[model samples]
Target: MEQIALKAEKRDISKKGTINELRRKGKLPGVLYGKNIESSPVAVDAKELLKVLKTHGESALINLELEGEKHPVLMKEIQRDTLKDAIVHVDFYRVSMTDRIEFNLPLVLKGDAEGVRMGGILQHQKRELSVKALPADMPEHLEVDISGLKIGDTLTVGDLKMDEKITVLDDPEEVVISILAPKLAEDTEVPTGEQAAEPEVVAKGKEKQEEE
Candidate 1:
């Protein structure tokens, strides 16, 4: 994974009121901690942080600045305002250049499957795979090639290979993606008109029986 050099400074003041004030001033409230480091409250811009997320995605390495020092970090988690799409809280984990960090790497499918070319549909069961690796050795994502897959062919975890430094957390037998024949897809939705007409037909049949 490509690690970009980004820095955020510590915030001297912190409180609910201060956070609200900070957001009003176009800043985001967050904290940086983990490993052998003390927790530091920090504030950054909402727009800039979002840009970093969009550019680097989940495989981002954040470099936090405190008192002229740079802390190599990763975004561990984030809390957001669901309605407004605003970031409410952020968690940053400090990582060592030598130690391995566990992260859920996204799975990217490359090359159209031969099955799909033959009118088959590709189904993906997992979007991300958990793995542990050194920060410098972390993969941005695992790419699975599906070029030769035919209809009913499934790509499972066992078919995946990774660098020696990376350890996949999921079971090797788990299915990741599969090519399904279009005819095999079953429609499970009920027909609204059929459902609405069934009761009237039953009522009419009962009325006819009573009259007879």
Candidate 2:
């Protein structure tokens, strides 16, 4: 539901050379399309988009301003360079405020549980969830409090709260987060025979030195 303004410009020429040149100038090549809108190659400030991704973590909605028109969009796919790991291209879906849309919202745990404090390992199996809801009703994050969690306690999709307009795509009883038993270290160290004998020789050398 949080919105950030991004400035974009329509592209007349779409080619690999042009895109690479744009990247050299720190611009990101992207396409925006949805519903009845025509897909157009557009360019936006790369640094600004990176800042938004950092602040919103892919879950935050974007308000893209192309020329003077504002479009509410969701980041559909981001393509990064394999060697450089830099964002090369991005795909955005223009969304309507009134229509219901599905998104994979991230799950965040709040509070340190007693079980985790008691030598239990906290395991998060799933990071995001699929939910259908209106764009205005979409939550930035799905918070699940682990304060009451025990060693074997688990939180499932059904345990989470959703808006009346939201529908969850995952199984109701699917375990999302759980605490497991902490791994214990082995009791004894098993030394190799040759390495163990080398220690005795060093001890003998020390004994001989002491005798001198």
| TM-score, cand. 2 vs. native | 0.83
Expressed as tens digits, the lDDT of each residue in 16-110 for candidate 1 is: 58888878988888888887878889877778888888877856877767678888888888998999977888888889989887898888889
lDDT of 2 by residue, 43-130 (tens): 9999999999988878678899987999999989999889997888889889999898989989888999889998898889988899
Give Cα distance to truth, residue 54, candidate 1, Å: 0.7
**What TM-score, computed on C-alpha atoms, does each candidate reach?**
0.83, 0.83
Instruction: In model 2, state the lDDT of residue 4.
Output: 78
lDDT score of residue 204 within candidate 1: 97
Q: For model 1, give the 10-residue run with minimal summed lDDT.
A: 183-192
Which residue pairs of candidate 1 clash? none
Off by more than 4 A, model 2: 14-16, 183-212
- Tell me model 1's lDDT, rounded to 2 decimals: 0.83
